[model samples]
Target: MGQDVYEELEREIALFLRRARAISKDFARAVHPELEADAYGLLIRIADDGGARGTDLADYYGIGKPTVSRQVRLLEELGLVERRPDPSDARAAFFCLTSEGEQRMERMRTARRERFQQMLREWDSGDAEQLARLLARLNVLFKTPLVDGP
Candidate 1:
């Protein structure tokens, strides 16, 4: 890619990240008045993955154990999450969303999906599908580690 193209891509990604952060904060606040903005992603991950351990979440997000533990504790205090003993490991526990959490997450997801549909209503269906596919591919690229360059 040309220098100009690379610069444009960087700019767009930066703007997207800003907007995403705002949206995530809003969504978390809507879910629970006391929900912390940074904890919103953790809630989503737990909901989507069914359940996960604090260590697992920390590893997945490339964050520190204390950070994940603090968020998980907050979620527990909010009554949005509960811990269940790991069937395979007596000493380990898995954190899962409560019914309230599931409902809140579903509502948030539905609202976001509707907003996305409205935003793309004027576009051709194929174009929207293409954008989704490309974004998914981009996410995959982010998840993959880069090899050392020569």
Candidate 2:
């Protein structure tokens, strides 16, 4: 790639982080009348993988295990997630979505899909799909710069 291409990529990555953080904050602020970001995240994880452990949630969210443990405790109190003894490791715990959590996750998915579709309306369908696939493929290899977002 040309120097300009690399420079542009860096600029876009920075701008994307800026915009994504703002959007996530706004999203959290707007929809938090029902659930906060951590709760919503746990629900999504459960919906994605059928269940997760506090450690898995911490790893996935890039947060500390103690943070995830606190969130899981709150979620359990809300009756959105239930913990069971891990069959593979009796001392450990696993969490799954309750029926209420599933319903909330479906609503979250619908809202997210609609918002993204609206934002991506100018893109060709094939190109959008390719971009999404590439982004997913790149996700593990790319880490956000520490200074980018709050």
Candidate 3:
């Protein structure tokens, strides 16, 4: 309701993002010693989406096609992902995790979840659910224009 409240929220969100970036790097290394931190998210997206086209990934992340292409190339080289021909489009291909990639990502996700549970062990389950709901709402808000302050 107050300007100070918004300022505090902004500060907390910034801190949370910074911490998340660091944790992402750690997780990426856990998956593969040579893996870059940014590619870790791409792996998760492909695994979750079942598969995705390079252009679709670019659009989802609001990044350049070239950037997504480079990451996909690296994933291919590492044997973490494979590209399959799109049945509908001769010129396009869909990326999906290879069996090796699927296994590694699954293990990493399980560990990450366990780590989160440990970190939140002191909080009640209801509080954790409330935090998840608030975060989901915040993510949805990020896609739309904010209302002007009164």
Candidate 4:
């Protein structure tokens, strides 16, 4: 509520976003050769949404439709995702992970979890639980506004 609190939150949030992006980029580079941040994020969104059209993905990611279209084309060329005609809407296409993509994602998620588990080796369960609770509360406190769909 205080000005000081707001400034501190802004600084902390910026640092957190930077460091988190670096870590994700590192992990992504290991899994995907020369993976762009936007492309990697699109994969995550497709995984989250079950399946989504390029227009929907652009809106969800707050990016331009042309950019989403380009990324989807690259992803398709790389065999990472498949674009199929939308069953409900014949004129639209939706993206879904390919088998190789799902396999790769599973491996990346497993490796990340293993790394976290190793780091928490000496941490008490109660401490871990407390940290999770606090982070969840913080996430709720700073939730971003959603950009309207395209």
User: Which portions of model 3 show Cα errors greater than 4 Å?
Assistant: 144-150
TM-score rank order: 3, 1, 2, 4
Q: What's the lDDT for residue 146 in model 4? A: 34
For candidate 4, write residues 1-150 as lDDT tens digits: 889998997899889899889877877776688676668788877876777898888877668999999888877777778989997897999899999888877787789889878989999989989988998898675556535468
Error of 2 at 81 (Å): 1.7
Highest lDDT: give the candidate number. Answer: 3
Find the candidate with the highest TM-score and give its number: 3
Candidates in descending lDDT order: 3, 1, 4, 2
Which residue pairs clash in candidate 2?
Answer: none
RMSD of 1: 2.8
Instruction: Kindly list the per-residue Cα lDDT of model 1 for residues 94-139, writing each as its tens digit.
Output: 9999999999999998997998999899999999999999998998
Worst 10 residues of 1 by lDDT: 141-150
Model 4 bad stretches (over 4 Å): 118-150
Task: Please list the Cα RMSD from the true structure of every candidate, rounded to 1 decimal place.
Answer: 2.8, 3.6, 3.1, 3.9
Which scores higher on TM-score, 1 or 4?
1
**In candidate 3, what are the lDDT values of residues 35-114, reduced to their tens digit?**
88878888889999988899989988768899999999989999999999976796899999999999999999899999
* TM-score, one value per model: 0.89, 0.78, 0.92, 0.78
Task: Please estimate how well model 2 matches the true structure, expressed as its whole-model Cα lDDT.
Answer: 0.77
